[model samples]
Target: MSKLSEKASEYLSREERLNVLSTSNKAGENNIAVFGSVMAVDDSTVMLMLGENTTCANLRENPRAALLVYVPGKGGLQAEGCRVYLRLRAMEDTGERFEQIKAGIRARVGDAADMLKHLAIFEVLKVRPIIDLGQEI
Candidate 1:
């Protein structure tokens, strides 16, 4: 079992959803977007669906991304201060690791099982948590 960082666990447990930021190369430039169906696969890895879209295209070119998961309700912006940035490397769609991620997603969002069946899964290669406990403003 992979143990997630204290910060990562806290964030995941508190927020049921995450915004995945995927960047792709477009004519030698970067394009980024916020994806809503992101899932936490263990403590270190984050999983999300990459449909046949620009975000997926960008990932194929450059498998790096950052994810921001905000706690729901009031003061959500303050929660943004604790977003997690990840260095991602696309994993091949085979083997046990892939299965593990699939299972993880199912466990997190059982209600969306039908929707997830059509989405492609990507994993986080590295994660960095940003927490501004000292910031007053």
Candidate 2:
């Protein structure tokens, strides 16, 4: 496995623990929602599941997306200007990658296997990390 920077790894892990904001396309507009199970596959890639919703529909039409996540808890690291831009690729209904991701999800959220069995897996490509530090901490 490729290793990520300390800061990047910390940010990704923290984001995995919290709900992430996923932005997709709509009818000439933008649709954003909170997703509970966003995960990082590597320093430059993320994986998520999309169901039959406006977000999924929009992704089918326009695959570009942005994800935002922040740290949680008191005295947690403040993350405001951090974002990830992804060029959405293929959406998998079922495959080896899907099983791998599902296993990872099961590790995080127990008892979600059956419920998520029908969800579609999305593979994101060319993810670019954008972080802006407002002030020195």
Candidate 3:
């Protein structure tokens, strides 16, 4: 597995950022959803709390996915962002990790935590600039 670059890691840590997870089913039907429960567990891993929805179902059907993280700028490609390719590593509905994530969600968004049904763990496959101008992440 490859590691995330320092810049990419920093961008993923931004509190005021946008995260959109893209996944496709076994038949290649695509799905994208805005997520607020995403966090970089380290440079090589990311974790998310997901309900039993299309996103979770798609990941189970096809492990490949991508997370587009963006931190808005005044305007243009100069914006801070990166496209993080990921592979589903694990999905746990019960465990220490799940409980921890559940508590975190409760603290941040109260009742929204009740909707969390799975703790999704993913391995970072690659990271690229949002515009993909042949620039390094």
Candidate 4:
């Protein structure tokens, strides 16, 4: 497993950062969604809760995905963030992580948390600068 750099990990630690998750189905149909629940569990692990939606279904067919963490910059592409390549490690509807995420959502959004369906865990494959100038995170 590849570990994310301290910079990348730190970027993910911020709760208000924008997280955009991208996934593709078996047929190559792509899907992208913005989420606030995505989080880094460790240098090489990430977790998020998903409902019974296209993102979840796409992951079931194809485990590979990418998460873009974006922090706005003063101008142009001077953003402070990274794009994390990932592979699905597991998906569970019930477990410690699931319970934690569930409770967190419930606390943050009240009854809207009921929409959460499964907790998805992913292994970090790589981390790169958001601008992708061939530089590593």
Candidate 5:
């Protein structure tokens, strides 16, 4: 159970934003997808929506991922820019925490979110900030 910094946590949950999820299989095939359902389970832990597809399969083979999350300017030139590179280690389980994650997905997206089956439970290994020029604008 790892936790993210307060700032990182706030950024992830501030609004539903798109992030890039990159994973690779044991054979080294790259898989990338745009995910918007990322959320911090707590401070050091995060959860993502997994579909029955390539991204999930990649994680099944290699439980590692790098998620790129960037927040665009809020108003024209005033919003501060923030970008993060998140290192994650994922697992599949139906344990208590997984259930909590399931509950969260349903709560956020409603019953239509049932397409989610397995929980890509991940621990935040690292949080690297990437400076963007837009923020300085």
Candidate 6:
């Protein structure tokens, strides 16, 4: 797995960053949801805590997902600056990784972690800037 860029890593570490997760269903219907329970695993993979919801159902049918991460400001989430969009393909399910990720989430999020029944592992396919307004953003 390759490591995430410095900028992306910084955004991932910030708790206030906004994340919008997108997926498509078996019938090619688009679905977007607010999913904040995500953690960067290594440099190329991410562990998204999911319940038995539409997002999970969509991913089960189609493992493709795109995560939009926005840098927070005094105003709020924006689309023009300091954003990293990631395209990912689902990885295979493994018992060891599932247990480890569950433990990790429990460690970080505590009791509420029980809601995370499944770990959706994704392989980073690509990362790109949303609007390159220059100035290292």
TM-score versus the correct structure, for each prediction: 0.57, 0.65, 0.96, 0.94, 0.72, 0.73
Best by TM-score: 3
- The residue-by-residue lDDT of candidate 2 on 76-129, one tens digit each, is 343332455666656776888777777777887787554554333334332323
Q: Candidate 1: lDDT of 46?
A: 68
Ranking by lDDT: 3, 4, 6, 5, 2, 1
Which 10 successive residues of model 4 have the least lDDT summed? Answer: 71-80
Give the TM-score comparing model 4 with the true structure, all chains together: 0.94
Residue range 77-104, candidate 4, lDDT tens digits: 6778999999999999997868988998
Q: In model 2, where do residues sit more than 4 Å from their true spots?
A: 1-6, 74-81, 106-137
Better of 2 and 4 by lDDT: 4
Residue clash pairs of candidate 1: 24-58
Ranking by TM-score: 3, 4, 6, 5, 2, 1
Local accuracy of candidate 3 as per-residue lDDT tens digits, 76-131:
86778899999999999998879987998899899988989999999999888988
The Cα error of candidate 5 at residue 91, in Å, is 3.7
lDDT of 1 by residue, 12-113 (tens): 665454564747564556666666556666666666664466776766677665566655554633444245555554544556755565566668767554
Off by over 4 Å in 5: 1-3, 74-100, 107-112, 132-137
Clashing pairs in 6: none
Best by lDDT: 3
Q: How many clashes does each candidate structure show, in the order listed?
A: 1, 0, 0, 0, 5, 0
- Compute the lDDT of residue 48 as modeled in candidate 6: 78
Q: What would the per-residue lDDT of candidate 5 be over residues 12-110, giving only the tens digit for each residue? A: 876755578888999999998977678777877777877688988888788778777667656454343234334446555567867777787789789
What is the C-alpha local distance difference test score of each model?
0.55, 0.58, 0.91, 0.90, 0.69, 0.69
Q: lDDT tens string, model 6, 1-137?
A: 33567777667778787778889988999999877777777678776778778888888788778787776564433453233334445533447877787777789778877776777777776666555544453
